[model samples]
Target chain A: MKTINKFKMQLCAKSTNESFARASVGAFIAQLDPTIEEISDIKTAVSEAVTNCIVHAYKEQNGDIYITVKIFENNKVKIIIRDKGCGIVDIKKAMEPLYTTGGSERAGLGFAVMESFTDKLRVISKVGKGTTVTLFKEIKSK
Target chain B: MECKLNMTDDTLTAELDGEIDHHTAKNVREQIDLEIDTQTPKTLILDFSDITFMDSSGIGLIMGRYKKIKSIGGKVKIKNPSPNTYRVLKLAGMDRLAKIEREE
Candidate 1:
C-alpha cells in the first residue's frame, strides 16, 4: 500500500516564523509513527535549515520562505525549503561545519546538524536568485 | 524567555522555561553564564523540565555552558529533559558532553 501526502506554506523569513515553520513541519510529520528521537531530529534539522533561509537567504530584508513537505507511502518524508532572496555564493563553504556569515553568536553548525539528522540533504542555490534545501528521511517502522 | 536559578551547596541548577531558539539565545546565554560565574558552583545542573521547545540554538547554549563549567573544573548534567529535548541533545552529541539523569 502506497500513500502520499504533500503540504506547502509561505512563511515570513523572520525568527518568529522560523518557529512556526518548524512546528508546522513537526506536526505534519507527527502523523506518522516516528520515534520520539526521530521526531526531534527532524524538527531540529528543519529548524536549522529554515533559520538559515530566514537569516542569511534574506539578509537585507524580510522575504517569503516556502516550505514543501512530501510524505511517501514508504513513510519517507522529504522537505524542500525554498527562499526567494539572496542566494548562497559558495555552496561548499555554506555546507561546511562551523561556517557562519553572521556574527549572531551561533555555533555555525546548522548545515552540519541537518546533514547528520536526515538520510539525504541537497542544497541548490544561485546568486541573486534563491536557494532551496531538500532534506529526506525515512521513518522507522514499528 | 524566563530563567530561574537555584543553588545548593556545590550544584547550580538552572530552570530554563520558554522557547529556546535563535532569538532567545543571547539573553539565555548571558543569564546562564552570569549564574555560573557568580555562583562558581562545582557542578552545574540544567533542569529542562519546563522547556517547551528548542532548536539548534539550544545546542549552542548547552555547548557554551559545558565549556564554561569545564573551564572551572565543574561537571555539567541535565535533569528532567523532555523527550523532544532529549532527542535534540542526542543528535548534537550532547549526551557525551554531559551526564543525564531522569527525573521522576
Candidate 2:
C-alpha cells in the first residue's frame, strides 16, 4: 500500500498524557475525514495502548512514550505506541482478556479492547528492554 | 473528570462529567467509593449523560464499583451512555453485570 502522510510525537509516559495522546492523534487523523464512530473507535484504541505504557510498561520508572500516526492507502490508518519501560515477559498471556497483574483496580481488558476496536493489532516486547503496540483501522468514505 | 453524587431513598445517582481515562478514573473511583462506604446505598446509578469520552479504564472503574456494592448486597445501574461509550462497555461485556440504559 502506498503511504499518504504521517507524524510522530513523544511524551512522558504519564497517566495524564493518556488523553493527550488520544486527542492529538484524533486531531491529526481528522484529515482522513473519519466518521464520528470511526474516530471514536480510533481514539478508544489509542487510549488503551497509551494507558498500558503508563500503568504497565513504565510501572517501575519514569520513561517516554513515542506515538506515530500514519495514513496509508485504502483509507487505512496505523498508530504505533512505544515505551522504553519494563517489557512484558509473556506476550501471549498478557494479551489474554482479564489477565492483569496490576492488582484489582486494573482490568486486564486493555489489549482486548484495543484488539476489538482496531481492524488489526500487534504487540512486540522484550523483558528488561521495552514494548511497542500497533493499531490499524479503516475509515469509510463520507 | 468529576462525579457528582446524589443520594435519597437508598439510591445513589452518580453523574459523571468530562473524559475518563487512567488518570481521571482514579479520582472518580475514590469519590463514588467514599459515598458508597459512608451512605451504604442499596443501589448505585452511574450517570454518563455529561461524559464525552471513555476507555477501558472506565470499565475498571465500573467493575470495581460493582464489586464494592455487590459485597454489600447492593446493585448497580448505568444510565445514558452515548452510543460510542456504549460500544466500549459492550465490548467488555459490562451489559451482563449491570443494567445499562443506552441513550435513545
Candidate 3:
C-alpha cells in the first residue's frame, strides 16, 4: 500500500471535457508503464465516470468534476471521479446495464463498462449532495 | 473526429478516425445519419481502422445507427475495429446486431 505517485485535477463538467479527463488520467498513469490494453481499460473506465457526471449529475447545469489518480506499490492504480451535482437515488437501478435516465440515445452501459474494465468499483452519493465513483486496477507487467 | 464517406449504388462506407467518446459521438452520429437519410443505401459500412480508443459512447453511436439503418431496410457492418474497440463493442452486445469484420 506504499504510495508511489499521485495527481489530481478539477475540470468543468462539460461533455467536451470527458475526453480531456480520461486522456489526462491515461497520461498520468502512463508513468507506471501500463500495457496498451491496460491504458485502454483505464481510459474507458474514466470516460464512463466523467460522462455520468456530465450527462446525469449536472443535467444541463454547470458543475465541477474532480479527478484523482494514485499509483501505489505493486503497480496498482486507483482513480476517483467526483462531482457536486444531482445524485442518484437508486444505486442498484443506476448500476444496472442498459438502465439509464438519460435520453434514448444513452445506452445506460456506463457503469457496466466501468466495472468490467477495472478490478474494483465503488460509488457513493446523496440525492441533494453529489456523487463519487472510485475505480482501481492492478497493472500486470509485460 | 474525422469521417470519410464512400458511397456506391447500394452501400455507404464511412471511415472514422480519432477517438470516439461522448464528446464526439453527437457530431459523428449526425454526420452519418445525414448521409444515410440522403442516400438510403442498402448497407452502411463503418470503418474503424483508425479509432485509437472508444467507450460506451461509441457503443451508443453504433446502436443508434443500427436502429436507423434497420428502419430503412439497410444493414450496418462494422469494419476493422482495433482489439480494444472490438472488446468494448462486444461487451455492449453490438456483435449480435451488427457484423464485425477484421481486415486482413
Candidate 4:
C-alpha cells in the first residue's frame, strides 16, 4: 500500500546550492498542502544536510551533489542527499554533539538539528567512497 | 547584506538583514564578536527583524554568542524574529536561553 514519487537533482557543492535545493524541495512538496512552518522546517533540515556536504565533503570547492526527494502517500517525505567526495570516517563520533572535524567554525550540530527536525534520520558513509544521508518526516498536514 | 550596529551607553544592538545560514553565519558571528569585544557592553541585543530565513547554523552562532557574553557577565536578548525563524529558534531551545521579544 504505497504510492511513491521521486525527484533527482544535481547541484554544485556551493553554499548557494543549499538554498536552491531546499527551495526546490519545499515548492515541490508544497503541492501536498503542507503548512508554511512544516515546509520551512523541511527546507531548513535539507539545507543543513546539503551544506555539510559542500563544506566538509568538497571543502567549499566544485563538486556534484545528488539530491533525491521521495513522497509517499502515507503523508511521509524522504530526502536522500548523496555526495561523491571525502566521506566521514567515524559516523558515530561525527553524530556526537559538538564533534567537528574541520576547524572552520562548524559546531557539528548539523546532524543533530537534522535529527530533531524529522522523524527518522540515517547516515551511510565510507571513507574515500562517499556519503548518503536519508531523512524522513511524517507529515502533519496543515 | 546590510548590518546595522548601534551602541548605547551599556548596550550593543545588531540588526541583521537577509539570511543567516552556514554560508553567512561565520562572518556574522565574527563581526558581532569583534564589536562586542571592542565595546564590552553590559547587554547585547540581536534584532532579527529583517532576517528572512535561518537554519541550524544560526542557532550555533547564537549559542556561541551566548557563551561569549555569559563569560563577561553580560546578558543577550533577541528581538523580532520572524514567525518561521521563531519556530526554528524554539525548536533549537533558544527561548530558554535568551529573552525573545515579539515586536515590530
Best by lDDT: 3
DockQ result, candidate 1: 0.41
Model 4 ranges with Cα > 4 A deviation = A1-4, B90-97
Q: After superposition, how far is residue A26 of candidate 2 from its true place, in Å?
A: 0.5
List, residue by residue over A22-91, the lDDT tens digit for candidate 4. Answer: 8899887887888877787788889888988988888887899999988998788889999998999989
- Against the hidden reference, what TM-scores do the models get? 0.81, 0.98, 0.98, 0.88
Ten contiguous residues with the weakest lDDT in model 1 chain B: B83-92
- Locate the minimum summed-lDDT window of 10 residues in model 2 chain A: A53-62
Report lDDT (CA) for all predictions: 0.85, 0.92, 0.93, 0.85
lDDT by residue for model 2 (A104-133), tens: 888889999899888999999999888999
Most accurate candidate by DockQ = 2
Model 3: how far residue B77 lies from native, Å: 0.1
Clashing residue pairs in candidate 1 are none
Error of 1 at A23 (Å): 1.5
After superposition, which runs of candidate 1 have C-alpha atoms over 4 Å from their true positions?
Answer: A1-3, B69-75, B80-87, B95-97, B102-104
| Model 4 lDDT per residue over B28-80, tens place | 88888999899998888999999988887878888888889889999999999
CA error at residue A73 for candidate 1, angstroms: 3.1
Scanning candidate 3 chain B in windows of ten residues, the lowest lDDT window is B19-28
Report the backbone clash tally of model 1: 0
